[model samples]
Target: MDSATSDESIIAFDKWLETPPGAYVRAWEQACLDKMVANIFGFNAVQIGMPQIDALAANRMPHQWLADIRLHPRQSGTGRAVAVTLDSEELPFATNSMDLVVLPHVLEFSAEPHQVLREVERVLIPEGQVIVCGFNPVSLWGLRQVRGRLTGSHYLPKAGEFISMPRIKDWLKLLNMGVSQTQLGCYAPACRTERWLARYNFMDRAGPNYWPYFGAVYMVQAIKRVKGMRLIGPAWKQKTAKAGVPVPAANKHKESIDG
Candidate 1:
């Protein structure tokens, strides 16, 4: 990946994390992860975003896979072991090691977005889920570039580079990941003054599936692909159990009959 882009991304994310409002942003970030868990299940999950928030809720709602992702000590509710890592470079874990990877704001802020996406692919299991969240350069965040420079938010540079949705999709394609869903947010810069507009419209009107400030960050869930990719399952053992006593799933009770 590009070194310059990677460096920029690291700086941006670190700075964003340091901000006072980061906690709120962190809690709010579960939008994409919640959707991923709702749409897909059965795979072991990995929450790669900030502080590794295992608690996620969105339009679709969080499900079983939500628990599979180990959360950090500080963020993990029950104190489970959680490993933190970056996306612009190779992870310590082996390739195809993760069933699901969440990359929130890790790419847009990074100068080398492709590198981050590639790294995501490297750690993902085949047909694994990848949910990415970032600012929409065309919407409120983009406008924030101007407003930020005016008010000097410090987070935004006076002038610099930005990433777009189409560009992100192209990068994913290059990495052999297919875009399953895309949504925008924080329709505007999402400041304290715009609370009403941000809440009332973020999930419904700002974009096709989301609304304004919609958190000011958007989410895209993609799937890694192999030569032959197929859907996994609905875990319906009862449907097949009627025919004969077949193989028992992970948690089923073992039974036997003796003469």
Candidate 2:
């Protein structure tokens, strides 16, 4: 969060904008994205605040939503895309309408993170899914967030700190989004040409797991809870009743903190 380090991050992001995402990293990201997208049904696939990569993902998986700063000239379905930009808090859709939404570092770069999340919470169905990917504050690659911004874009935050996964989980809990799973990626330094170093399987596992302190990015999947969360299945209760007179009550709260 040093002033000088902040400037450096900004410079780094500028460097990134000058190039596209690395092929290996992009492939891994797309793999994870595909898994998340495939789980939804009759739901909209929304990629917020990342028009370029969202477009890429859309192209890779034609079923995924394709977004852009401007409407796509050739694709008439561009009108179906929820046209939004940085600072656009109000969604054009109804409550509980969206089935899936992807936040590709929008939380890290947004000037009003909470408001954006609130918008997400508003549009999500009770059983909706949201996948978030962001720079890990602790990773060598996460420290390069400033590079994620375009120079002079007011959408970026002015401060810098490790945006801890735990903190994000807490925020989602407040928004009624339950944490389902998390994965860390790019634990080593961001090297475009030196990816040969990660070809070894052992280094890949150790870095993203044990050495997450050096990760470039991390991902989390959260789901909105349904009302009337059941303590026991109906069939289980009937079977247990056949064998016992009473059912013992136990701890009622279960939470995931790997936010």
Candidate 3:
């Protein structure tokens, strides 16, 4: 999609957050994020995109900031805290500076998700943790999304590339990061009404236990790895020679032959 269309799609999706399905997903994500980020101690933490979710609300970092391409001088009201308006593919933070990063559905909306992940790898320090939330493309929600797109009435954002969990893991592995933890939630069907959604609450218990990999949403925690490798071998020997001085090999046969 073009830039204008992408922007409109995101705006429409943000407005949809007020609806029942959107609100349900937001609550699930917030609860998951709270449990994951509460134990991570950091000096600086950044939450990129999805400013409405408040991904760092449970974090105890001394310096917490939210960044998004949509945040601007006019649309500065990003929930509880102010957010900086910047592209996720090009963050302004220094290299190896951020201790933690939270991406709440940013990759799905980004036109260049790989570039955004690369930028996240760049700004984070070694062993820094990154929490990513995404929609699983192999579940009931995924089926609904596909049907919605085919019918031209998507429940989620229409103009995003909904990436799979395995694909995201591969991307992280290529960046020298390892997945530390994985969480799956929101097993209910994509229902527009809260009453119908609550009716399928039993699926929450059954879905994860019977079909572990079929959750509608997933959260992955990854850590950047900095391997320390050193070369071990014999040290090089040095020989000193002064001007007009011959370096002797200390061989008696050479001396006797010369005499």
Candidate 4:
């Protein structure tokens, strides 16, 4: 998609996030994000796009930024003020500068999703992590979205090229980023109204156990690994003992006699 089209799609998606179904997805994503980022220790973190959800609020990182292709203020959610506006494929930050990077629904909307992943990998320090949230293309929600497109009505944003979890994993693997953790949620069927959503709430409870792989959305956490490098603990933990000084034979004999 062209930049103009992409921007429009993102804006529409942002607006959709305020709707009942959009809010439903946002709630699940927010909860997942909070848990995924809470324990991530880092100095710098960046959340790219979808300012409708604060993807890093639970994170304790001292320096955090919210970035997007276009500056959008927080509307229905709490998040950091937009710190930077730039393309996902071309981050302005220096290579290996970020400790954590959050991509919430960015890949699905981007024209060059692989390039975005490459950019993320370039900015992350060794062992630094990236958390990605995306709509699953293999669920009931996915079916509805497809049907919506065929009938000239769209359930999700038309610009979205929904990617499956396996594809995302492969993309990360190519960048030497290993998937460390994952979460799938929002099993409720695709319903426009809040009432119907509530009626199908039972699916949310039973989805994981019965239909584990077909959730509407997924969150993935991957860690960057540099070849032939391993993280070491504090230097004090690996301290070595010093060699003992040698003593003259006469002094050693005298000390023995005294004893």
Best by TM-score: 4
- 1-259, model 2: which lDDT tens digit per residue? 3335534544444345334334445555667766666645654666764433442243233334533222221222224454443232555657888777787665654445677678888888887878887766665555455565545442123443447777788888998899998877755454545444355446567875577555566778899886685676679778888888644443222223332
Best by lDDT: 4
Number of clashing residue pairs, candidate 2:
6
Could you tell me the lDDT of residue 15 within candidate 3?
A: 77
TM-score, ranked from best to worst? 4, 3, 2, 1
Listed in order, each prediction's TM-score against the native is 0.60, 0.62, 0.85, 0.86
Ten contiguous residues with the weakest lDDT in model 3: 235-244
lDDT of 2 at 6: 37
Stronger candidate by TM-score (3 vs 4): 4
For model 2, the superposed segments whose C-alpha errors exceed 4 Å read 1-24, 54-64, 68-88, 143-162, 192-202, 212-214, 229-259
**Is 1 or 2 the stronger prediction by lDDT?**
2
The per-residue C-alpha lDDT of model 3 at residue 62 equals 95
The digit string of per-residue lDDT tens for model 3 on 1-259 reads 5566667767876777778888888889988999999999879999877766778878899999877667442243345555577877789989999999999888888888899899999999999999989999999989988999889988777776888899999999999999999999889988889999889889888987998898989999999999888966543322233354665777766887899
Model 4: how large is the Cα RMSD against the reference?
6.5
lDDT of 1 by residue, 1-259 (tens): 2655444544555455545334345545554455556656534555554444553332232222222211122344424444453334455557887777666555544555676678779878889878877666676556767677778784443324566777778888888899998766444344433354345444445355443333455677788998776867666776677678656653344334321
Candidate 4 per-residue C-alpha lDDT over 186-242 given as tens digits, one digit per residue, 9 for 90 to 100:
999888999999999999999999999999999999999999958787766555322
Clashes of each: 15, 6, 0, 0
lDDT of 4 at 258: 100
Question: Which residues of candidate 3, in runs, are more than 4 Å off?
Answer: 71-79, 231-259
